[model samples]
Target: MSARTSAPSWRPANSSGRSLWLAIAGLSPPAIGDSHTGLRLMGDVLSLARRRPFTSAVILLIVAVYVVEIAQSRPAFWLEGKGDLPDIAALGVVWTPAIGDGEWWRLITASSLHAGLLHIALNCYALVVIGGAAEARFRWWRTAVIFLVAAVGGNIAAAAIQPGAASLGASGGVMGLAGAVVVGAVWSGEGLARSQWVIGAIIATVAFGFINPGISNAAHIGGLIAGGAVSLPLGLTARLRRTQRPAPAPKTQARGTAPGRATATGMNPRQVEFQRRIDAAMAKARAEREEDARRASSGE
Candidate 1:
């Protein structure tokens, strides 16, 4: 059974602009007449980290990769003039020309590559909150698969639209994580009210597309679809597991009898008596027929 969900104490009563900002930052405004705010806020953040190990690890990887990318992307680098990040160019940037030449691995590899500090930070923040919630709800492996599938889908979408343009980042995958949560909720019959947060997250993702110029909306959309595709099956599987019944054991038949025939073993008294009567009748009929045949031969 699913764990019971309740309204979070930290959730604001209304969706004002300030409230939205707080929600994005994963923080709550100071309550009326509350003094232990710092302690409570720290506790919430720590609790989140503890609950989502996979999310934390993914964030760390993104940060580490970004650090390496900045260090390597200098003026001396060969691809430095071509693009901002040399690490992205060397490691894996979704350059359509390269992909056309069979460097298809960029579809997956570009997910870890970022343009700048701002780019990585934004993506990491989304993953930490949205992806962490998803990981907490489902298993670690499912979350990982969803991220990868979304990443590939996003890159493919970008390449299809902008063949010559280069793109890199985890935004596509992050958007996908949000999309999966929303779709999974609907598939599981969690209802609209229960899925409001996920729905809001999708809206926020799309909102970012309009606000940010460099953001790949196509990749975001593709990742969203990919995430939903991967998570839908999990929902169906969970439903089947919940409703599936144990199969009945096979019945044993009597020796020399056809399948579905009454078995010799475990026969009730009435069935045993009936079988005995039928056998006796058959024997008497055979004896009478044999006697009649012998008499007819002798008389002739």
Candidate 2:
């Protein structure tokens, strides 16, 4: 019998096309065919973390909290769908009644919580993309301010609009970052081509929220508005600073001119006219004094 040949056991199951696409997108390190691909990817992440320390810190904190969440609940809770409400509440998910009862910190804390592994995974990915861009462009402090403000604003809106519903996740803050990017681009006069993809993504996300039940559209809208509002003044200030011109250096005084007077060379029409009037008046006074002196001499 002829010897049979088989495919290598170490090869990945995914099609070459899919693997190639994933590799191109930088989404699958294993597909790159290099044993050190993971190490290279890790190094790249470390480099990005160094450049975006605040974004990295926020992402790390969210991940750490998620780890605690996993420990407190069944494996299925994270892997499949929604977790136990009581467990989630204990872990700081936002509930309107709790906030009403003076557990207001939940508004801020709930943003750091997530509904499931998928939820947190999507959020963290968005955070890495949006937060990193924001930090790179707007500085870490401004990015932090935008994230925190949007989180609180989103929770407040949810509490007001859907009092009976419980909410969790960082979608609001992510949407807020999207809004800030859009508004920031407009104010800074950046090319629309650069931001059109962001705009399309925002529209698609909001549309998806509307289609999907249990999604917090109110919080999303609130966060978008709050983020845009915050970014407006910042963008305006930055644009103003960029466009501002220093006042022309004060014209140097002519060598023979008085300290307060400017040279005619650089003077405007109005200034030149004023200087001419002053000179004419001084000449008239001198002529009058000379005439008086001549008359007095004749009288003597």
Candidate 3:
């Protein structure tokens, strides 16, 4: 479920190229793409579903939650949309279980819940795209951890800095994925270049101005940090990932026999091969993350 991944890793930021503003501002938010509109988000998912039945299920998850929220609004199932957008951070904090006042499960629930239909679709699309690329070189477990931390940190940060308002979206985690992938691209010499990275980061930072306030910059920044911090111990040296040959794609098997679906959505064999590859990659990255966490926990 988590598209957050590893095979996509990072290289250290240029410290000497420091910009105090970068520190103060964080990597800017990606253009909430021109295509990104609330209604568009809702429509795009539905449109994609026509060609791919599986994507229907993805939409179902979002609809199911919205249904729950509406039902809760009816004064029955639960108060608020499982949790309010305004209260997401508070819920994650004071209401989160065991730790503060919040339910322990919110850490997980928050990922599933999103700001709105717009939020849900955007993140889902991101998962399919970036995740497709990442899993090719990483591991699932790593994806899960990255998703969890990025989503949780993003929500927490948003709540802390922009408290008293409900907000939900996989964007925080997706943004983390964005940061991780951008770093990965730079390190691996893949999709983008280092100069492009800096430029993209700058544009994103500047676009923050037009983000129309109330968006969670905190969560965005926090997720970026989490991606970077977590990447450090994954053996992601400057040249290691850059010079490496790409990992092979995961091979598929009989329809039901494939360990994982070749294509969760309506996809060609090539697409399936691509997904299998990325999933395999994500799984590998997760293994590394586990080892890294283990090492840190053991003070190794």
Candidate 4:
């Protein structure tokens, strides 16, 4: 009957006592009539869904991606194999840059083009699920970065790895989104550790391989690598791309101040120090969060 005697002395002392006990032990008080932890946890989704702006747009993106792909499937285009570049040329079966140039823009453009209606449909389905979830875990720009980079990476790999091939499909990029979800879940702070997602991705990959005759594994792998890499520092790096700025000068060159040179009218040292601290703190937090996850995974 006593806590000292029982190995598992966790039994509740009836409903009334249990309620009182929880109230006393609660760190954050619960909502009235809502006693379940699952309810509270499900009640908040911003960190998962409702909080992300890019999520809603992603729906449109999904739709648009499929639409364009569907259109490309028609016989009007001159690209071989209905614009399925990888299938046509990855292994040197056929080759040309007819669909989209082997250019950087093609990375994104290919996402909008596909082999057929079914191909587009499958990709959109994957994107909606993966992109929706990715948007939930990562910031909007971060999601955008993974989408862009992964998509580009997939196309690039398709071009490089698949020799003499013209490939078109949202598969590479969308798969990248899936890769982001899987990897981000792996490297997250607290959420997105569902084993189901990983298992599901594996199943989907296998299914895609069996169904789509020319599915380029190269692109899928590349996009995944790109997504994981782009998850860090995507924001500022993106700014440089948009502005087309030349390389960022070293600290000494940016202010036009030589290594040891400064005029009476100089930059604010205090402000600079504060900015440095802010940057350092942010870096530290991100590193700590990642480290905690690493340790937890390693059984440390």
TM-score, one value per model: 0.63, 0.69, 0.47, 0.49
Query: Global lDDT of each model?
Result: 0.66, 0.68, 0.48, 0.52
Off by over 4 Å in 4: 1-103, 189-195, 210-212, 232-300
Quote the lDDT for 115 in model 2: 57
Residue 138: error of model 1 in Å? 1.9
> Tens digits of per-residue lDDT for model 1 on 1-300?
101112111110100111232365455457857789888878866876688777877887877876776677653322222233333466787777788889999888788876544455556667767787688656677788888888899889877865545667787787678777787777777766765766776777667565654456678788888888887886577668767967877766654333443653667556766776787788899999999999999995
Model 2: per-residue lDDT, tens digit, 84-136? Answer: 45555677666777888999998888788765666777777777766776777
TM-score of 2: 0.69
Model 3: how far is 113 from its true place, Å? 1.4
Worst 10 residues of 4 by lDDT: 9-18
Tens digits of per-residue lDDT, candidate 4, 46-120, equal: 443566566556545656655543444434222222333322222221122532443445555655554444454
Model 2 ranges with Cα > 4 A deviation: 1-33, 240-300
Candidate of highest lDDT: 2
Candidate numbers sorted by lDDT from highest down: 2, 1, 4, 3
- Candidate 2, after superposition: displacement of residue 11 in Å? 38
**Candidate that beats the other on lDDT, 1 or 4, i.e. the better one:** 1
Clash list (residue pairs), candidate 1: none
lDDT per residue for candidate 3 within 1-300, as digits (tens), equals 111112122110100111322343343433586656667766765765554443344346655765554543332213321332232333222122233354555544555554433445445655544443333334444544565677678666655654443345555665555566666666555657433543464346435623534344666677767764564444174346555868888555535224545434556677767776787788899999999999999999
Cα lDDT over the full model 1: 0.66
Each candidate: RMSD? 17.2, 15.4, 23.1, 24.8
